[model samples]
Target chain A: MSDTLRPNSSDDNQGAQPLYVPIKRRSFFMYAGATAGATALLLTGCKDDDDSSIDAKTTVDVGVGDVGVLNYAYALEQLEAAFYAEVLKGGYFTGLAPAAAERQIFADIALHEQIHADFFKTALAGNAIKALTPNFSAINFGDRTSVLTSARAFEDLGVAAYNGAGRFITDPKFLVVAGKIVSVEARHAAIIRDLITPNSFVANDVIDFSTTSATARQERSKLPAEVLAVANTFLAESSKVSAKSLV
Target chain B: MKLLSLLDRLSTADAPAAAAPRRDLLHRLGQAGARAAVAALPLAAALPAQAAPTDTTLDAILLLLKLEDMLVALYTQALASPALAGAAQAAVRPDFERMLRHQQGHAQFYRTTLLTAGLTPPAAPRFDFSGRRNNAGNPELFPNVLNDYNAFLQLAQQLEDASASIYLNQVAAFATDRQLRDVVLRTQLVEARHASHVRTLRRTATASVAVKSWPSNADVVPSPAVVVPSPAGASTPPVSIYSFEANEVQLVSATTAVPFLAVLTGATAVQFVALSEAFDEPLPTAQANALLNIFG
Candidate 1:
């Protein structure tokens, strides 16, 4: 493992080069073998922190390389899944008509996020990060406006995170996998935005719209460090995640 | 040596003009020297062995440009059509305009990248929205596509979904250029947003079209409602734009699956649909080009 993993640090410099040390093939296989099948590896890897001194306050650093990218996605998916799960449990969602479009949307999105979180956890296996507890106290889930606004932010953040992290992924297959999931997140972002304000699916805030240059119409992407800064605000101090090595 | 040769072929075959302007454009794009900048990257060094005959970065950019050009035409024509004069259609006109602008921006981005790399992008083809392939004699696979609002929305949904999938399929071709790959990924998400918006419009426009914001097995697949004429000796059969999108199994490698069964237990029918909708599948290049050919 790399020694760059740190706790509760703020490193948001995009100009800084990544401090990445690729995991050796031999060591990867060794870890895989020692953990029996790869499925148990992720569970054990996440479970190891249970008895360790690392508590909720310890900032979990998403390590470097492809593993770092996977963990980064895993962390975001976990946050999203937890948020939607909380929303489903809250008064607003429960208060909606059982057959309401908003109710179905929330239920479907909750399942999608859970599946995404589970997929990453399975794919990362030994490289998976421990589940982080979300801090959504700022979001009043009892109110429709507050819940939808926070949902938009999380979905948009998830899309930008995946878009920005693609450059850090070395494996072509991992890039493909990230490509698969980011689009769904973008879909989620569009619908959530539309639900808040109709026909506002592709807004100027989330997408660059420059009159001088047509090529700048790409979606605004956020580096891992920048994303984590906002994400940490919605996460508990102990469950806050960092990607220092990723930068 | 291989990188140099590929660059040489690109410059000679595509751009016979003076190299000074190309170098200037590259410098302005933060790539000081196209040849030197590309050669210095690790991905560029490995491209010779990894790239297939048709898998060049240039090919990926050109394909994306074509896709975007088609979308730009689709939106421009639809917005100008008299069929969209209704209150419902007028309300969503701005959404189509926004989508058009993004497609134009994306197309411009690819065109500039090719020029910066000392290549000439192919000219935009004349698009026929009726699916008659710019010929009156051809069968219309999508009748009233531009005349009927519901039909227009259906075609729009399919095109957006197909474009997103095509972008997903071509990510590897841009591996040699990280900046290009990043743009492609961002644009791919934008395409997904367009797809989701269109699906929303379709769902709201009618109760018969059951679709979600994201691709789902439970959603009704949009069809042209006409038999597509296949090219002679074509190996692959004509497939819907949404074909194979319902696949539940996701492969991380050739041998290793994602093991969704083991991970997501208690296989309820709804959960199974969620599993498919969780990950968007990539459309193969041949299938994508075939769809594009119908509207050419």
Candidate 2:
């Protein structure tokens, strides 16, 4: 189980290169406004070299450092918020009784995800990434099993993403805020899992429960690159996100 | 004072003879002092001149170890209680078992982390879930915690919620070691999962006790019937685990709030509830210790 959970080293190596170096340069200019003349010249020289080999349209790098981590989270939240918004309008939700627990649950979660997405946008301000377009063609929201299974995947992935990204945040305040949000994501994941199949909230798949070690019940976290691989599937090609610098 | 003394013992009991030099301890204390000074600038003049020793990483680990130890004892005893032996609880017994296993794992993790750092964790406390401080003469704040399923679930929900808050409070203190910080983050989410599961159980079991999977202002306040007396003999309000959870405004800095109400506008009431429920507030270490001491 641990072997499978171990991050793919080769994938991580691929993620180490800055595929979206231009994005970072663009945001840096937006954030710093007018830099000193000498500094601007040095930055432009480096920018041209980065643009020569990489097509920025093909992939969206979340940037680097704390901003990259924030964008990584922002990207995931956007996906969740979009998925839940679609779920609310789908046949399955509309078909349920107005007062049904499932309906209320979906409504509450929709609000939560939107709150998360909007919060990141506000917090990041100028450094925030443009909203990515969601591609939910794979999801049949009219069906309960399909919508819920996708929800469970997103919630679990969100939790793992935040958990894994914590070490990368240099700012204590950001880490603290991330801590506040990740638990809510965990709560959502648990309830979603429970709704799908009772008593599976802390199942072995999301949590390490290997018998070889008595103390191996920690929750498993996924690196940013690992999370993006699954998240990009629900995102449109042009809007697909990457965390190359995050690795 | 009892709680403070107990924490003092837990913080100091396992120190090795070859502890860090006094100068090093003072240096760490100075850093903590600066942080506390900034945090308490408004009240600095009114406060005492002598500063107490601030929590180090070692203290944080020990405090969490103490918390996990109490949780493990609570779940272990509850599983054995005849109150949960009936058919209704039979369906949820697996949940209890799984939660217990995770808590035991957490406790072991903290203990091992301490040992790895060359510090010994203190022995687990004898937990009394009735909130009597293990004294028969004292008033029982949670009378049916072990005998009634509803009572058990109520206490369990609060404990789990408090556990998540306590972990959040300590995460930033571990910034010096990113690996340890990430581990704390991982463990903290599991605690949140546990809290959500317990809250869900409560919501489904009894409609009378209003609760959502996440903390919300709409949830009924889980207060003790009797106000416990402070050591000073004044009636102390019951220690609430969710005391700070109903905060709607979040601060990105000292002066500015996240402005959730203005930004996420709709029905004012619904927005207010969502704003508060969106973020779980951190419990101060002193408050957490006080809450834990209720079950000492």
Candidate 3:
């Protein structure tokens, strides 16, 4: 989450650039059970809010291995799949109705979101995030402009979510699957941005092809805590209270 | 009869593939997953273990389909462009169509794969490259993607880039399916080559490469002076507006540097490579978008 800091509170985080805030990338990973670590994080989330609190619960007991991390991801996928299913239940609002290209893009994006949700459900099976409810109250779906703005934000966050998490999967096989999913999510992000304004897919701030020089491919992304925070804002009150870290 | 003809057309157009039995098995499994394949993906670490030669057959074919779609879309736009002169078209057309046909074969391979496995190939959509439904009178009219060369190419670059990124990452991901991963890498290299070529055209026709560079950090439409693709080393490549890692080792790659979306989505701390040399910083999706929107 520190890889790129957010100027505003994670909840109010709208459009802050990497330049303004400095997020330190968490590079250290001691060999620990991925599933256990996730459970600890989630249990931490489930416990009454406390900065310094340690209690034991029947957490998803997992061995310290790549498989543990995978199960952790599987858990998040469950959350994500369940989240989008509810968002599109009534279908996204037609923001750029006059722009058929944009509308079509939105529809495709919705399908992609649903597919992503389903994919996780299938991959995780029982371990998938319990069909938990999402909280999008902060989003003004009635206001097309506001909604698109938020969609742009969420899509990008979704892509970054994958980017920030990729390295954790030690297994080459799972890493590959992660990559496949990230691209689709990225595509969704691009299309949504393009819908808002054409040719505005990957701006200079994001792409960095240079090798010898600095600032090559440093776009931006959101942290798990931040992502979960926003996800909670959009969810019901109960979910927010129980919302734990998906990172 | 139509189905048989379609199959023949697909077969004749396919690049020389491998042994029939082996190829058939790969195709069958690939088709079974179909739409279910990429339905859901995490941010960075989605690569699963299908890379093993045993079950990776489906992943291999799907990767082919993904690559083929990207290539077809790229060529359809490039070839259709009136500005693209003679020799380039004459030279690039077959290869482009060949890419499309390859996808057709891959798609068929998946279908056959499903049949052999006693499953059904998922229904695919008739893709609209134009990015438009051609309903000019419709209230929500999208750009006639075919007519609007700019937007089409924009998408083409993204898709090609996505393909290239995935291919690059799969290099190291695929364990058992070494040969299949190699084939995908080859396609990925081809796509990268394709991206470079498209970039060159963008420079020649309209704005400089800089202008074409996507996810522009501007609220207003950028001026031609924005200048992109400056001497390759001038500016750092920004993070892709989008990302993916393929591989049940679907994104199995040759190097440790997995694909962009893979790195971004399911990326582990160990796999977190600094995106560009300039900004020692690694921005996530939210941070990146927030910055862009500020300028927007």
Candidate 4:
């Protein structure tokens, strides 16, 4: 049993080995086995952190790789979904223009966010992090101005987050999924912006000035850290998402 | 030997036959030099292989650049039209100018990218929005795209919507290059915004216009522009721009059709329009290219 557990000491004695043998093959398998073992340990070590019973004050590390980015997205979706769900429950705020249009758009947007949140939840399955609790105490759900303004902020932040995180995603399918979802977020962003101020959908504030063309402008992209910093302000201590591993 | 091995690895997966013709691929390699190929191996591994037969980076970039160039020309012509700057549409001239600037900027960006890739960017084609192909002999499809503001808005809405779909079509092909994918996706959404804004402009201009911020089933609504009658000896009837957008069914995956009405938790047939509006479908590459040929 002791010999079985020990490293192959004989294999390390290069002088005794045949000179014509391929050394690279043995080393490759040895590294592959070590990596597989480390990966298993890393995954298991983070399982408890993903539990639903996570304390509100706990700092949750959205672990690296595809799962990490999806969770990061999940957290934002959860926040937006919760916000819209609450807004719909309370009814449209006063002073909302074209009341019927606003109500319908808001309802549709709320459903879209909820669907996005649920989709990520299903995709991550057992690896998904705890449901984030958004702290919207400061936002007045009764006022159309406040609610729409908050929606704009959330939609813009969501767009920026997805745009910024695109480069970090390693899987092509995951990136395609992100692309599918991000455009919806963008459409939502445009609608919310236009609702707030007509024709200001892609205003310079949210879009960076174009250096490539004198007249062309591009939408702004935010790094994970910058986005999370803004996002955490609306999230409670326990539900705060950390993308340190992702970056 | 290492270079030969590198070539072998790259070709094996994609070769049509054991000894596939690779003149273009080999020419690219020859131009890149042997040292660059050696350096590019690790980077090449990061590029996601696409299954589409013609979705090469050069093709995607060239197509996108052409689309942008067409847009720049369209907007420039619209802004230049004395009718647009007159009293009837005077208030919206600044907005049209803004749109023109964005298209010009987009066109410039695409040109720079092509040049940076060491490819010669195609020259701007003489665009005839009248759809007469600059030849009086050909029948006109869009007769009032530039002179009439309402007609202009309708055409603008169609172009912007088409732009969004075209970008969506090409975006997946860029998956291999993270930087390019990022740029494409970011730019794609801006097109979406532009589409929405154009739709709003149309709706505002005509209270009865059946358009929405997002595309609805009403996408099938007949357009005032683009009356393409089949010529005397034509085989296939030309597809109208509005007809292209009025699609309800969409593919959520390669094989799965999104059950829009079933999955959409709402009431009545009107809500089906909302379901359609909820997702924009991608237009196929061949169709998109065909549409691009109309203005030039």
Candidate 5:
């Protein structure tokens, strides 16, 4: 533990005097995206060094039938909650110009995602998915713009994730419930994107004009694995998780 | 004229009040309700109404069509008001216009039925968004809307939520008419989406805004065991028409005007920035007429 062996503060320093700051920041964000994309490869099977001790081969069952859908929701909530928890951990990207506004928003989303996670946990009870860890080394938690843009991506994806998965729930009641929550997710997505750029939230890309149903104005969805990959980047190693397929 | 004096009498009430519209809404809905169940009532001849109640099936369709027309008219007028300004003004205009078009489409669809039934459809009026169809010289309809973005948005939200609730009830109560039922459901979903969009717009205009959309997880149907007895059906029923967005907007508005929002299942319900987050019930045609009377 000599001073020479100690990690140098300057090595991690970014933003100023760092010719490589922008490149590193860009690469870091893409890292989260990359991790998400490579999750199937990473998660093909568990590694022995699992620190959180959250195992898929273990006894935590997400539920049977509709419970699977709830468990799926619980899984996503865990990822969202973990992301927000980490964002607010250091009080939201220090030294950013919109730090205060962004932190408040971060705090709100953190609370919401956490609440959503808890709602499914309670609703599913024993059938709920176990907590998952998130990996954030790809995110420059220290960089505000990257974090917010990353946030916009996550929020948009969360809304889409919930919406695309709506029809999968077999129970009529559960489907309606999914509708209610998905709309809210849409609202959160819209707000976050609006903050990033005004009027960018509810675009035709997000709403389906071809839909015949009055309430069917939501965006088309991507695969669950795809959405999870985007979410995985935000998950740190400590937040590993898994849930039964609700769909 | 009495309605005018009634409104004048309440001149001392709060500047931005929704109570007047709420009461008028009841009368309007009462007419629609009566008209909807007209066929069921053997005493249709005894009751005086602008339009006679035909049969329950057509009654509901006609009422729904009327509601859609009114919604279109109200939205058009609100957006047209000289009082609205800036982005708040711009944001609502397109939505209002789209809604007007939708309402017209609904009207046309129902008009086909009315025509086949040997009845003439009601004529739609020119919209006065300024809320000034009253007081020939008073240009104060939708007063302080544009410059006062909150007022404008609150009104916008009020209309959207009202439309959402009405659509919800229509979807549940009128499951008998297959074609109409399908149309109602389709339009109802759009109404909810429209409501969601308006809510987001309202929140965005105000800096203190939070989630405008409801969670994607709340149940639309009340479970069979928990299902409240609805007038729509005669026997005890199971939860079939569940709406997931119930978490965002409650069904309590079904029982009365000024629908109250429920707390989210979580200890902390979702947050929204507004003068008041509760639903501002729609004034049915009768009720809207009542408000219009107040100005006369």
Candidate 6:
């Protein structure tokens, strides 16, 4: 997966040719919007045959607009997929989840995350960010306590991230798509939390008890900046997904 | 947060023909005969919630309030039940207690929001956990839901699952007000998590319970053998709360069902279960309201 990131050789090639390049994330959306169909055609066309060349961009920017948000999700899914894949490869926390059924659950979750990652990739054909390299140095794959705790953190973060980003979504269809995926993420979060501690699924820490009304059960949300602050600890700087303008 | 975004991808990836099939649901909403059993009050005497729900945003908020009300009632009854509270298993008590508190919190949020909006929050309806609507004359649709732990869990799972789908169905309605949309969407995931934990608890207790953390076509709950009427003697077909839940097919467009078998690469036929598990199907407002009537 890490091999998917390669330096852009096209930059050197484009230096010889006078090409129109987007200097700001906002400009990318403007250009894409002005020639919506053509922009889609270019993105799809570029990925179909010259995916390697396109993937070689040193830093893949999840551009602005709904497309940027989709790319942002695609980037996160890539990291999650890699993390679970590594977990399974490392024997699924050994004695912690030695049972065949427990391993199967992890495998199924891995597939779900991979499908999520792949869905975003296909949806954002050319605009999808490069596959992220996960730094799992902080995680102890062999220890059940360590692995499950990290899984809980990642799942809860994924849930909060989607909730915070929903307002920025413009297209109704896109909002529907996000709703579908986030529920599944919430499900994953619950199960992982339960595995860590039977009914610790909706603890006060993850949900806000202090709403305008004291009794409202508002699930806590993290802005992109806050989510990335934690998510970036595991993501290499080169592949960091910037949600600076997501709102 | 991320859950809402995942729903976006799930709609695009799973529901290929989402916008069209829902027309059938819209048609059914007109036919869902029974009105919410709130007392008739003149506008001058009280601000009735239903008087001017012409605005979708207002309508969504009201519906959400009712939904949260139903949950709070269900959990309140369950926690009060001697069967559950007196069980040998002490761990389950706090779970329901915490759950009840959360529902109360959600109900308070909606109720206060409605009051602040200058509309009177609808009076809370009486709930019968047995699905008999507290009428001694009616046969029980759900037997011993509050008394039987397993039965309580089954109902809990269904309500939570339906809660998640119902919120997803209303997301578009709250588009006009982003703050309300955020609250609804955020609360929506909390419900899904609640559903997951309940399902997990059920799974731990019963070897026969075949459910995952998320909804799936494989986890089919057999339809009850009997159909019962509400207190007002409104006899209806067995509720379809769990019927549409096991659906594997999702629409991508008005007319297109994304061929999951064809498009998803390297996945075997069995992985299709994972596909359905990966995305939850939304429940229409009429069907949701119909199901919510079961507890009233």
Q: Across residues A122-230, which tens digit of lDDT does each residue of candidate 2 receive?
A: 7787778777889999999999999999999999999989977887898767887888888899999999999999889989999988633522787898899799999
Worst 10 residues of 3 chain B by lDDT: B272-281
Best-fitting candidate, scored by DockQ: 1
First chain of model 4: TM-score? 0.74
Flag clash pairs in model 2.
none
Per-residue lDDT of model 1, residues B146-184, tens digit only: 788888888888889888988987776665567777888
Q: What digit string (tens of lDDT, one per residue) describes model 3 on residues A64-89?
A: 24544444444444444444334444
Q: Provide TM-scores for the models.
A: 0.80, 0.80, 0.40, 0.74, 0.51, 0.75
Considering summed lDDT, which 10 consecutive residues are worst modelled in model 3 chain A? A24-33
User: Model 5, range A210-235, lDDT digits (tens) per residue?
Assistant: 43543343354655556666665665
DockQ of 3: 0.02
Give interface RMSD, every candidate, in order: 3.4, 3.3, 14.4, 5.2, 8.4, 6.6
Candidate DockQ scores, in order: 0.41, 0.38, 0.02, 0.21, 0.05, 0.35
For each predicted model, how many residue pairs clash, with residues at least 3 apart or on different chains?
A: 2, 0, 137, 3, 58, 38
A220 Cα displacement, candidate 1 (Å): 0.3
> Alpha-carbon error at B46 in model 1, in Å?
20
Q: Candidate 6: which stretches are off by over 4 Å?
A: A1-56, A93-101, A211-216, B1-55, B206-208, B220-239, B249-270
TM-score of chain B of each: 0.79, 0.78, 0.45, 0.74, 0.49, 0.73
Please give the TM-score that candidate 2 achieves against the real structure.
0.80
Ranking by DockQ: 1, 2, 6, 4, 5, 3
| Alpha-carbon lDDT, every model | 0.74, 0.74, 0.39, 0.66, 0.46, 0.67
